[model samples]
Target: MSKSSVYSWRIDPVLKQDLEQAARTEQTSIAQLLEQIVQDWLYKKSSPDDEEVQQRLHEAASQTFGAFRSRDSKGSEKVRERVRAKLRQKRATQRPD
Candidate 1:
């Protein structure tokens, strides 16, 4: 578990009402909504200036590939081999060379 800090602050009632409505519509508590909003804001603020956009952007493909691996031996290699096998099967069916 990670440590968290609590702080007190005030916002306009109108804004708070809007946030509450949005939170309700999203089926989440206001606290979780606010936490997620703050986390998202902080992440965007910390990101590169060139990354400021409404569309969600992912990291470089090479950087993300093989990020999650199984507990088994040669996990990444196994995944690659499976993908290759599927491609080979598809091509064999399609071209029959």
Candidate 2:
């Protein structure tokens, strides 16, 4: 197991109430919700602008081939294999020439 650090902070009551309500709606604790929001904010703040290139590629591939509509297991397996192969090829092509 990894060690963890604990930090404490304060926020306005109105803001805290809103966050608490959202956390309840999401079925999570206020601490967890705050942690998630902070982490997301920090990630967006720290990430490089060009990181969206890879993100967009991944989203495009997922949107194109992520879901299988087939009920047949064999057909699904074939589709998975084909999509996996295409993804591999695409990744290979994306590598430095």
Best by TM-score: 1
Taken over the whole model, the C-alpha lDDT of each candidate is 0.81, 0.84
Alpha-carbon RMSD, candidate 1: 16.0
RMSD of 2: 17.4
lDDT of 2 by residue, 1-97 (tens): 3529888788899988898899999999987887889989999889866778789888888877756557676885487789999999999999997
C-alpha TM-score for every candidate: 0.48, 0.44
Question: All candidates: CA RMSD in angstroms?
Answer: 16.0, 17.4
Model 1 pairs whose backbones collide: none
Candidate 1 Cα misplacement greater than 4 A, ranges: 1-4, 51-97
How would you encode candidate 1's per-residue C-alpha lDDT over 1-97 as one tens digit per residue?
A: 3648887699999999999999999999998898899999999888866644323354544455565545787876588889999999998899945
